[model samples]
Target: MLVLLLLWTGCGSAVPPELAPDLILHNAKIITVDPDFRVVEAAAIKGSRFLAVGSNDHVLNLAGSQTSLVDLEGRTAIPGLIDSHIHALHFGWHITKHVNFSTGERLTVESMVARIGEWAKNVPPGKWIYARGPYSLDFVAEGRLPNRWEVDAVTPENPFFMNMQGHVGVVNSYAMRLAGVTKRTPDPEGGKFVRDPKTGELTGIVYEFPAMNPFRGLIPRHSLEDNLNAVRKANEVFNSLGITSVVNLAMPQWEFAVLRQLWRDEGLTVRWTAMLRADARVFLNKPYSEVEAEMRALGPPTRFGNDWLKINGIKIVLDGFVEAAYMREPYLEDIFGKGWRGILLWDRESLKSALRAAGKYGIQVAIHVTGDAAVDVALEVMDEVDREYPVAGRRWSLEHAGVMPTEENLEIAERLKVIISTQQSMGWSIGKTFKKWWGPEMGGIFAPNKTWLQALGHPYLKAGSDNRPINPFIGFWAYLARKDVDGEVAKPEEALGREDTLRLYTSNAAYGIFEEKERGSIEAGKLADLVVLSEDIMSVPEDQVREIKPVMTVVGGKIVFQQGS
Candidate 1:
């Protein structure tokens, strides 16, 4: 019957028919992440959807005379990669403008100071010297934190700076004085101000919200035009990595305005799903009517709004980074035996109330839960709220489900149907530090991907690059292959198989964003978002997976990225 339809379409003329298809790609290996996870050799595409998928000959036979053809030359193709969790604005902003501390041979305070001194020579004074991407604790045994004095030495007139793990930052004495933070300055409700015990002076090392707020205020506010430029640069980088879709976590209203402007100007080149940052109070109030009104005014969520933008849900940051002492877990030994178990953004009651409201309104919630204790609390809140509101179809996600929870908690997550938006790349990037700080017993509990997969029974979505570089391919390579970027296998036992890894980025990630039916996989009726890679990921040696480059990226039947072109 299928053959007959193809023959009839071919017999009429070279062209299949109007409204049939405008393009057909043949002679290729297409890994369609459909229900059966089919691997087809060719496909037929209309304006923005796949018309058919099967043998090359069958799809080619249905091609109309005017149908543009692409011969894949036996290259490998899969669904367009989606980075399920990334701070889109932050990622773009930092990459283009911030002082990158990731470049140095040694990521220490002293090394960073030297690097900034060099950067200061080229940059003018008085302007904020923004820098990011340094892991201070990665090298030193005591793990020396950079103080304002260290940064001041590099650029005393200029405000020298660098972020700690991209979550918090340290500014020089100049910046601190400008911000008016002094020894007497009390810590903000959700942030911290580190100080020297002897001198009673500000240390310049800020932790969590308090440390971040003041500095974020110091940076020059971006104009609408500047934001648009940032968006363009972001898209260029995304295309270079073959990323077709991204969920921009915690997009502010102001930034959304700029995105809208870009949409009107037709300047966007990447598909985005935005999660608005709902601060604690706003979210607790259950401001559904107001939020809905705002969304309606902004317009409905566009899957591929001109193939460049979309809005999926709302983001709620429940906790802070574990290493920064913002996590709720009890530290074994605090400095001077002064225990600090981190700060919770909101009380349990407030969290439950907000999440319940969000669930009732059909808005998906992406909660940041990093620590084991924090995860337990977050899960309890979700479970309690879910029981009351009974969200039938909403996909609630637990971002940064990094630390291993108790088996009972894992079972609870599976039962509650919560999606674990995890960072698989952390195994390679942050795993080392985890081993050191946590010791053997706790280190083993950090990011137990294999354990979660086994316990969850295949429902969790592996989707996070929260503070690291956003690259799904690299993530897949690391998680499945258990190898570093240089192809050195780390922990083979924790490795997921190739097929499961693909699902993590494709169907699993799509399900997390509530866009499973529209995107995520290649099916007859789904949007044609796909990527062509240099090698077959499944067939390659585990170590070499990182070397595979994306040769092409197509979204809605239009080619968005082509390697070296």
Candidate 2:
């Protein structure tokens, strides 16, 4: 009996200890972005999760014989950035194909025409030629709309069209002819066909819904393979920038199908949460049981689909861009002394009904509300629905929340736990234009980010790039430095501290996506998703933040990207 007891004890002791980690990273400045926002020196990864995060000695001790060790070489590491709002497939498609007109001296119509003429000469004859990201209104001091004749002079045979802000476009005569639009073609409801004042002819400029439908039908439909290729290209760009996850703001049904195909094929690299476009009428009109069953069959909303993709929420655009004067607001006078109030896509009753129905189904809604008036209306609808359906923990978000929201609206949002998914880059990009239109007082009131800070006293605010060439670093700089893209400082008093700005991109963004508990921070038991930067962002001068580049990016314990040595 004594021998047996001793043998049993020896056997238990001989059971091999748990194996150590497969990877260890040490001698690094690691910004955890955790609850305490801790900074550590070393981190150990077992397979796809952080096993230990602490001192270099502690983390190194967990490294097994075959563990790959990475010396940080004095570089700085932070949590992998997750863009809260981006049009993933669209961005990919446009970047790969479209003629980017956002930059250069060719901002004016004449310059644009000259450039298009140059482009048309090289492309195949009769091919569908497309260009995007033009800002003709910016150059037209009188806010003159571009007409088909101007574009026709450049590419008469080519069906040329370019989107100004995703909500409006100007097409050439060929494209217009293909769409069968004429001067007498009545403007579709909820859309406007810009007309020549003297001739009363269609000018090829269209706004809101009407403009979108015709071209949308004519535009070459992306094949599943083409979309997958686009996704691959997008992932390469994102991983290069250390962006591991992104919330695709709005994806069309076909694009969603492509994403699903990529996921099934295990080809997706970046984690995605897709917001189904509200215009997906067929899906929205389906029976609740049918919809639920379809969603279930596809899969639940996930952070990474256990590896790559996720479907988080639905997106709805309530109004048009602020520049187009389509945002509902305190009416402002245009250059011609015409008072133009903004246009709402859906009537108040329709919006309210949709919100109520969405809330009932437990689907979080992300509504695009740019102007204060629009914000107020959205809040009112959300509040009404919350009173009835009462989503307890779901994080509904207000996209763009650019203008100053009312104190009452802020309070309600705080109480109901709605997130302000703002594009801080706007303060730099378009805030100057607002100042010109409304003057100092009203313009200052327009992007009253400070007002929200004071009213709600640190509400859940997430920073979004809006895919305007404003990455996390640019956003950080804008928020902390209070500087415009041109290096001019905005209202200094509205500027947030560096730490606060970081939180806006990291912790707050994660919270907005209902992913706060998993990947926002660097900690044990959490996914080892992080980025290493060439410079220490926290300690760098505010003006230099944009200069910093990602040196390395890790997702799910694997190094996905590394800057060329």
Instruction: Name the candidate that leads on TM-score.
Output: 1
lDDT of 1 by residue, 336-384 (tens): 1356565567667767766665665556778887667778888888878
Cα displacement (Å) at residue 374, model 2: 1.3
| Candidate RMSDs in order | 3.8, 5.3
TM-score of each: 0.88, 0.87
Residue 113 CA displacement from its true place in model 1, Å: 3.4
Tell how far residue 333 is off in model 1, in angstroms: 4.5
Local accuracy by lDDT, each model: 0.71, 0.71
lDDT of 1: 0.71
**What pairs collide in candidate 1?**
14-64, 14-65, 15-64, 15-65, 16-64, 99-130, 99-131, 191-210
